[model samples]
Target: MNWQELGKQVADYAPLLGGVLGGPSGAAFGTILASKFGTKETPNDIAAAIQADPNAALKLKEVESNNETKLQELYLKDKQNARLSHKDSRMPAALSIALTLFVVLVVYLLFFAPVPDASKDVLFMLLGVVVKEWSNAMQYWYGTTRSSSDKTKLIAARN
Candidate 1:
């Protein structure tokens, strides 16, 4: 199957898996597919491999679990570090402000202030950025793993 077909198969079957696999699991699945197999691997290919070797799916799940553990550890450390400093940190304060404005603008335009279509369009465009950034900030579990260069940078930052 082609990439598009593989994506379609994932979309169709993923929801049935439920939980993380069902919701917003595309990135995780894609990472597993691309890294374990290859970018060109398809759903049919995965299914065949799993049938031939039952360990195939298990290996992918292991990768996902390891990534989740690492992200959880890192996130918890950030939380603990903040607590030890005795300072509350709103790391996304500016994003919060922008999202607030987006909500207010949406509510205002929808109910009270019937804005022009062009202005509404602009508001929606800005709202999209907020949504995208919010997702990306939480994407470590399903996002691509750090490359060697990025790993070096991460180690350097620790020192």
Candidate 2:
């Protein structure tokens, strides 16, 4: 099974770790889960272990709590790297502009252009792609809800 599927199964027990398992760094987090559970380094095995053990959820929570600091560090480092890359290259900016233009074009086509019934489906599919890409670009440029939530948590902890 995929990491996402495994993540769903694990979510009931450890929401934070399940989210990590479902993200871009799922494999890395999966390895951590495997090691913690004494299972093989695979989503399937880890999921099975989680199912077999009655205390899996509690153990997973402990693992998540123990690794929380590392997770935060990883998130900070990733954001730092993105910022550094943006400073060194114009590709991200260029791509963001291109994506924005494409989205605008798609919106115009959907609303104003005479789209054929047959072509409408294709256009809609392209629109979905554009929307997902636009969201990624927005996240890269403005940060995501996760970052905002993290910031809030940090502020709360400081108080």
Candidate 3:
């Protein structure tokens, strides 16, 4: 049997394993299960065993419960860390102050300042661009960016 073929089988099973577990991290369940239970057998052997054992799915589902609990715990810990870090950082406070000042300036320019209509229009357009750019930057930083290594793995798996 081809080594890669066996790997492909496991890869194919990963999503199913994930589905049984039911979570964002379910895709990782296959790797964890393989590590825990896979010893000498190839993926084919494991599949055959699972087919033969009537209680295999049940057992795997039981493991999924444990995995889901651990995943949830990790998520909570990460969220708590994020909150604490946000509180400790000065950037958020600085940004808030700067945005408040900008709002005040915009209100003044629009309502109280004897600015020309043309200048006000220009300022509004410029502010719109700035806001869009800032939103894009924030999304880029906070979004889930796929790394080159992940792409490489995907391409290699395909082959």
Quote model 3's TM-score.
0.34
Shift of residue 113 alpha carbon in model 2, Å: 24
Error of 1 at 68 (Å): 2.0
Give candidate 2's error at residue 142 in angstroms. Answer: 12
Please give, for residues 39-108, the per-residue lDDT of candidate 3 as tens digits. Answer: 3344455555555666666656565556666755644665556655664466754664565567567767
C-alpha positional error of residue 65 in candidate 2 after TM-score superposition, expressed in Å: 0.4
Write the residue-wise lDDT of candidate 1 on 46-151 in tens digits: 6455445546556555545656654345446645565446433455455556666666666666578777887878777766776676556435223453244367
User: What TM-score does model 2 achieve against the real structure?
Assistant: 0.47
What TM-score would each prediction reach against the true structure?
0.27, 0.47, 0.34
lDDT of model 1 at residue 109?
64
Q: List where candidate 1 sits over 4 angstroms from the true fold.
A: 1-18, 38-41, 69-159
List model 2 lDDT by residue over 33-110, tens digit each: 888889999888988898888888788899888988776665566566656565557787899999999999999999
Best by TM-score: 2
- Worst ten-residue run, lDDT, model 2? 79-88
Badly placed stretches (over 4 Å) of model 2 are 73-159
lDDT of 2 at 147: 78
